[model samples]
Target: MASHLLLMRHAKSSWDDSGLSDHERPLNKRGRRASGLVARTLVARGYAPDVIWSSDAARTLETAKRLIRIIPGAQTVHHNPALYHASANTMLTIMQRESEPGGRLMIMAHNPGMAELYNLITGHYHRFPTGACAVFKRIGKAPWHDPQSWRVVDMVLPRDLEAE
Candidate 1:
């Protein structure tokens, strides 16, 4: 059976608190709003994931919380410190290692890793802005690690949604 893979960058984060480390910074006001909008859009489009893998950073966790609240279909979210600013290979390895066999999976993380992953899978350059998601459809019984097995289905960007 086919499954869905969603790679999303965390929403815009606050740099207001200069004292706070990058990992400790939370989402900004615009980010919070964008998070809700993206979550709602995902549900409306029937793209909600069965499970979520997210970076343990404050922004990513906050984004995940917003998604969970809006999309009740997601089973659970696993936060991993290793995912924080991870490279594309690292993200792919962790995803393959932690993912369930056959179900929709979402990764809430940071870039340029997110963008790199999208490029690696689709063989095309894609801008993965904050609060943006790239949806891929995994063909039947294909390995998640195989780029040939997945096809880009959609690119959901907060900017486009905001303009609507």
Candidate 2:
């Protein structure tokens, strides 16, 4: 059976505090609302992750927490500091080394990496706006390190759900 993989970019962050480091920036008002929308959308689409591997950054952590609140079945959440601004290859490497086998998994982190990783895996370029998720079905018996093994299945974007 194929396993599910979800890649999510952190929700929009607040730029109000110039003194705060990038990692310390919190989710803004729009981010908070968008996170909830994304969470509900995940549940509605039956794509709620079994486990989440997320950046330790404030925005990503808050996003993961929102998901946990709405997704009753969401089980574990791991905060990885290395994922804060990791590259696409780094993200895949970490997942391959850390993720458990045969369950829905999610990665929540910053962009450039998120968008790059999506394009690498799906063979299609996508600009991952804040609070966007790319859902994939990993092909049978293939490892997470293999880009060709993943097939893009669905997407959940905050803008797309604004009317919902």
Candidate 2 residue pairs in backbone clash:
none
User: Candidate 2 on 1-164: residue-level lDDT in tens?
Assistant: 33888999999999999999998999999999999999889888888898898999999999899889889878878999999999999997886786455578899999899999999987788899999999998886666667777898999999999986
Candidate 2: stretches off by over 4 Å = none
**Candidate 2 local lDDT, residue 3:** 81
Q: Give per-residue lDDT, candidate 2, residue 63.
A: 88
Give the range of the ten consecutive residues with the poorest summed lDDT in model 1.
95-104
Q: After superposition, how far is residue 154 of candidate 2 from its true place, in Å?
A: 0.6
**Candidate 1 wrongly placed segments (more than 4 Å):** 99-101
